[model samples]
Target: MAGLAGTGLSGAGAVGMALPAPPAGPPAQVGGLRVCERGDTTYLLDRSGRVRSLTYARLVPDNRLWVRQSYDRAGRLTGLSVSWSGFAGRLLDVRGSFDARGRLVRESGFRARGVTTPLGSYLRAVPRGLTC
Candidate 1:
């Protein structure tokens, strides 16, 4: 995905959402990137202090979904993916792309059927330094 070009993620993702505060340990620095952990969630910040990626667990109804967000070099969100732990391992639920202006462009996957996309929610919840 275009947004993933400089972030090392090969899949689609983008944007940042409010996550719980980190527990106690300091953020870890790796190769100029800062990794912050809060419970089952992790946020990766680039050298310029932009969110590069976010991986977090979300509860939906009776299922627990793992969500990932990927951003471009400018810290603009581009794509998102959701998955869930299954008997066969992690099963993808939905994957969507966002236009540069943060509109949901395309989404697919069986679990995505009939569900309102969360693009607006994520855009509204984007954290301080990140852009949707």
Candidate 2:
């Protein structure tokens, strides 16, 4: 039987089996720095080569942003936060949970002060269909 990775869930479900490989040339440039891109998605890598943030333009023309947190040697996320721009600006204070394999199993968010009040506990489930 095909495992989750074989079934196209590898790398946090960012890659699908039928999807073409990322471009083979040098990474894309943003702000005079090289960035990794998959199709139109772009990722910002820190000096240590870890992903620091992501920026993508949605199909509807709205831009999405994600900020990643640092982790300690023990593999726990030392901090977590996220923000999106649309309808003004919305910020989320995020916390992540990981399984034994270090894969993120869940995440919780709270609306930061000065942002619009989020309905329901400010928590939303990560949809399986989402990439990145």
Which structure among the candidates has the greatest lDDT?
Answer: 1
- Candidate 1 lDDT: 0.68
**CA-lDDT, candidates in order:** 0.68, 0.49
lDDT for each residue of candidate 2 in 27-101, tens digit (9 for 90 to 100): 565554457656654555544455544444433345454544434444334443455555455555455655555
Q: What lDDT does candidate 1 reach at residue 5?
A: 88
* Candidate 1 residue 80 C-alpha distance from true site, Å: 0.5
Q: Report the C-alpha displacement of residue 11, candidate 2, in angstroms.
A: 47
> Residue 116 of candidate 2: its Cα lDDT?
58
Residue 111 lDDT in candidate 2: 62
Question: The CA-based lDDT of model 2 is what?
Answer: 0.49
> 11-111 in candidate 1: lDDT tens per residue?
63345534688787666786777987656667788877788788887675656667788888887778887776454444457777888887789987655
Collision pairs in model 1? 13-70, 13-79, 14-70, 14-78, 14-79, 15-77
How close to the true structure is residue 126 of candidate 1, measured as C-alpha lDDT?
38
Instruction: Return the lDDT, model 2, position 128.
Output: 25
